[model samples]
Target: MQELPGVGLVERARAVAPLIAREADEIERSRRLTPSVVAVLIENGLYRALLPQSLGGAEAPIETFMQMLEEIAKADASTAWCLGQCSVCAMIAAWLDPDTAQEIFNVAPGILAWGAIAHEARSVEGGYRVTARWDFASGSRQASWLGAHVRIVEADGTPRKNADGSPEVRTILFPVASATLHDVWQAIGLAGTGTDSYEVADLFIPERFTAFRDVPAALREPGPLYRIGTGATFSLGFAAVSLGVARATLDAAIALARAKHPSLAGTAMRDNQAVQGLIGRTEGDLRAAGAYLYATAHTMWRDLCATGEFSAAHRSAVRLAATWTIHQSAKVVDAAYHMAGATAVFRSQPFERRFRDMHAIAQQIQARDTHYEDVGKAILAGG
Candidate 1:
């Protein structure tokens, strides 16, 4: 197992940010990360941050993962988005059998990407059979393996139930070659992710290749990092990515203000009291959002490490912090974009791409307003 070559994960991500930044336009134009960018990511071990150390992965703390994504997003949000998607997907290895996990993640360019739950897997002899299509697979373009989350049913088509009476859902993994990919990721922003849809008809997955992901009872690894659910980890990572985009956009605005003189204005934009105040206020907002997110993640991580358990309160706090940070980051980006005036609308300017990418991040399921409602309900219930 080759070790990550750098001072740390966050530093490594920051060091590679410029390389990805140079490739940003090409990445967006091609609607996928350039081969060079992908190679850099793999070589740096950024894709293996969340995998178990037992498998030669960094297995860094959630806070480290969040910070890493933020740094990457400072250069390119699409790259950050893809990295976060695939990194969190690696958590499935904790629930898989040791040999199976080794086979899937311990190989060269070991990358796994999966989509949302969209179908059912029928229980059969020794395993299950599934014929379903899943969408929004963000990093499929670079994944060697693909996965689908589906509810399980018996051979007679009867839905399998957990101890709590809810339907059982299993994530079935298979080589990417076994599925058919569709080119359907065209969008206003984050176009480089290649978040296409995929389908597999009448495919049989062996029992060894399926796992009860995100379920506490099924974890085969005893690491504190895997204690937090995959969904929450994703929320944290993407929220950090949002902050990075917002930070870069605001910095660009600040740079423009320092150099540009408005038409007919007596002085540079930076000399304007209004622009100074806006910059100050937006900076404070962005800082506060980032602080809150990191604080929440740190507190939860400490508690989980000490107690070896994750509570409902921890989940609610993380969801609230992640959602609020994403929304606040969008506001910062919007303010910065408007403050840049005519320069922001031009394709050549840095502001436009980050603006589009920030909005696209907000539009993702993790940023939905319903998350706030869920947090509110949890608080009201004294959870």
Candidate 2:
């Protein structure tokens, strides 16, 4: 009921921060957002921020959407992760048939979750039949639709190939009920993301419900947001989540340092020169990383809007900024956790959960240090 109409989506996300913060404990314990929080997210239009406007969605700019994720993440990382998963799935609408896309996203929840599958889909008369178990299906608990990325094959089990002589891969969509959900999301961090593994056997997927998982030229929408492509959008948005979690952890640590006295030290942590220096330097580092992330995202978004295409430099810059931001955020969280001392290790303290969550984020593929090599290669190629 606390809807703030006429405000930007980022501001709207900020408005829900208190509620998300209040539910953080329950979310972690239950391994999913509560129904009430889900309803609030739906009512606030948070899930539709990345959807095409033609389908009753916001069609928000990439920067705005990433900022919104940051605001939500400051309250709870799991919630922010789920929001990112669902919203980015909506972006796939740009490649879907209008009728099918509308039908899938127009549902009440309109959330889609999926995972990687090693299985191959055997082509049939009208569609393909897939039997595979996908892992890391984040946000699956509340999704309306589910997807599986499969390699296409012929009836005799030979892999299908595109005109360019590459193996054809397609992401086939199916109703959430068609897949059997497994309650194996037990994780030390981001437990509330509900990133469970799912199974689908002999599930029939019509051709219209599938598309090339990474082909940008096939997108149906002409908006710049879609033009940026899913890889860049996910990297930037997830990096913002890392930054937000780091921001919250640093704030919490500062609060504890100012109030509690260390047993070994005669004075409070805030009075200790070492603690002071650590927090000060870490804050500066976080701010610098955040500035780079946002600046790169804004530049890419702007360039795509004006030119309808992104240069190799722009793509490499986005990936480099994201990888750097994630690593820096993890460092900030580690410093904050150490500064909090014994208090940080307790579940009663925010640093404990954030420390675990930040590490998990760093382990994601997008946050890997190898991305630096990709950026370096791009620079060399360009030069």
Candidate 3:
């Protein structure tokens, strides 16, 4: 791993987020960033940290990615959501062969924004023509590229067959100019994420630009970094998002609690034993969540960098740990909301914003019922 400079990208990201925090409510209502706010994040290089140095990027560690995302999310979930997705897009740029990597990244390093996961892709004479309606393309509104998972289909546009008549899935990359974005991210919470839909009709992607989702641990044709799994990156990065939102929630609750008193009226809210206990509990949960999350994510990534031998089981463990941290964050934020009482409910209160954001975090599939079940099943089967 390259040694980063003092204060680090994570700390710098936090420093830049305070202003955005002030506008989180507006962001939730507006469903997109104001132009000025968007510029602040872009100048800060938040989107390119996951990109490789060859492309004039930070190439920061997974832990740094999380810390940065958490800070961005703390300010505005939608901005962070979109920005985080863009950062992940840079991940694809870092994994391809150098020649292909240069074509997408060298000309405009840290500029590509992508969406989608490997659902399927297949071979063709010139390249790969892909089809899929990738949902949750969080950065589609400001992206220059679109990506999705697609399987090979016949010349007639039907799914192709394998020798055994089975199936295979692959990642497909397409320039944003060739795709269409569907503005359908209308929800009651985190509306600012602008996670609209994108579709590509017979978009042909050059073979050199595509990276298989399941390359071996850190083994790219030209760079070992290409071997890492996309899931690993998402697990670590999303966990940081959870942490950031939780931290913001706590900060807001503390500020509100200090200014107000408990309705039961024995003391100021901050001075109340129950409130203190909840705060104390929330702090504990946040601490454990962060500690476990960073420890597990860093361990796996470090092991991969050191020996290039991290197993699928190890990766699964990181996924479980990251998801669990998010779950813990939700629990703590819920307690913060309860402790803040009525103040937490008002739109003027940051708690109201954080409350919604935290709920959204817990509700995301990665942090919710499905991930929990995956972890549970894995543990039961000794995964």
Q: How does each model score on TM-score?
A: 0.98, 0.96, 0.88
lDDT of 2: 0.88
Top-TM-score structure, candidate number: 1
Candidate number that wins on lDDT, 2 or 3:
2
Report clash pairs, candidate 2: none
**lDDT (Cα) of model 1:** 0.93
In candidate 1, how many Å is residue 187 off?
0.8
Candidate 2 per-residue lDDT over residues 1-383, each given as its tens digit = 64322237998899989999999999999999988789889999999988888787888877788899999999999999999888887888888989999889997778888875567899998999988898998889989999888899998899999999988988899999898999998888999999999998898899999988558778888778887777788899899999999999999988998888888788877889999899899999999999999999988888888898877778888999999999999999999998888888888888888898889889988898789988887778863
- Tell me the spans in candidate 1 whose CA falls farther than 4 Å from its real position: 1-7
Mind giving the per-residue lDDT tens digits that candidate 3 earns over 1-383?
Answer: 85562126777677778878776667777787666667777777777777777666777767677778887887877778777777777677655777766666555323555555544454677777666677877766666666776676655667766567866455666667788888898865668777888877666778766665555532343333444556667767777888888888887888877889656698877778877787887898899889999888778777877876667677677778878888888887788787777777888777776677777767776775676677778889977
Candidate 1 has a TM-score of 0.98
Q: Could you tell me which 10 consecutive residues in candidate 1 have the lowest summed lDDT?
A: 1-10
For model 3, what is the C-alpha lDDT against the true structure?
0.71
